[model samples]
Target: MASLSSLLPAPTQQVWDRDDERKAKRVGSALVVSQTSVPPYGQRKGWVPRAEEDFGDGGAFPEIHVAQYPLGMGARGKESTSNALAIIYSKLTDLLPSEVLAEDDPTLQKPDDEDIQDITEKTKLALEKLTNAKISAAMPVKAAPKAVS
Candidate 1:
């Protein structure tokens, strides 16, 4: 069987180091805020702004700005928090692998439609299962006492 690297395309004519340098610079400045305190229950109707910060100066490079906020307290809040964390995790992990494998050759072709479809179907089924479990958990259950034998 061919090794994984053997399947990849030859490195492009562009300088790999230059691309790595750019990625390093951008990732070095990337900021991720986590573990922020949630607002009191029903204190605010929806997402509440907690803090905001700006970085970099008005120079050759544009400044970067970020706003920090926590979801409200309840089911909606929990879902929002979960989505926010997922996004942050995806962004961070997306950068991590590239940084480690910056020198690796790029794939010659995009993923086939069948592969994408298969993944989508699997994801949908998994989500359906999770939703079913959550629904079952939320439902009230009755317990029957056993009579003496």
Candidate 2:
């Protein structure tokens, strides 16, 4: 089977989950939080001349970069994405029972109703909140008063 990348003009392969390379190793900011304005930039008269050496680029809190799968591609791409999203949906969102997820049951095939992974991103987020996944932590809210006080 051909990967989605093969069809592209310039195909590229992605290597996911290299936390060791991306995370900060020995940055000052990683150890200590320092908010310094270094002579307030514009004040030329009394500029306290100082050299600050920051070895690390604050990789401890690296910005997340995600590449989402194309929705309306083709059967091959759809199958791949469906499999991926199905796993996440089943595991994270608790759509399937623990037994099913653990491969204890033989009902792992895609359901006939709909492709579980073929839903919109919005629905996925909602599902995450519903399952109380760490990625989509739901805030606590008090119930509204039913009648007037």
- Among the numbered candidates, top TM-score falls to 1
Off by over 4 Å in 2: 4-20, 24-29, 33-36, 50-149
Clashing pairs in 1: none
lDDT values, one for every candidate: 0.54, 0.44
**lDDT for each residue of candidate 1 in 55-92, tens digit (9 for 90 to 100):** 11212111223233322333233444346545454465
Listed in order, each prediction's TM-score against the native is 0.25, 0.17
lDDT (Cα) of model 1:
0.54
lDDT of 1 at 93: 65
Poorest lDDT segment (10 consecutive residues) of candidate 2: 53-62
Task: Residues 15-90, candidate 2: write the lDDT tens digits.
Answer: 5656755564444236675765433324435443232321122221112233212222342334444464443553
- Report the backbone clash tally of model 2: 0
Off by over 4 Å in 1: 1-108, 143-149
Q: In lDDT terms, which candidate is top?
A: 1
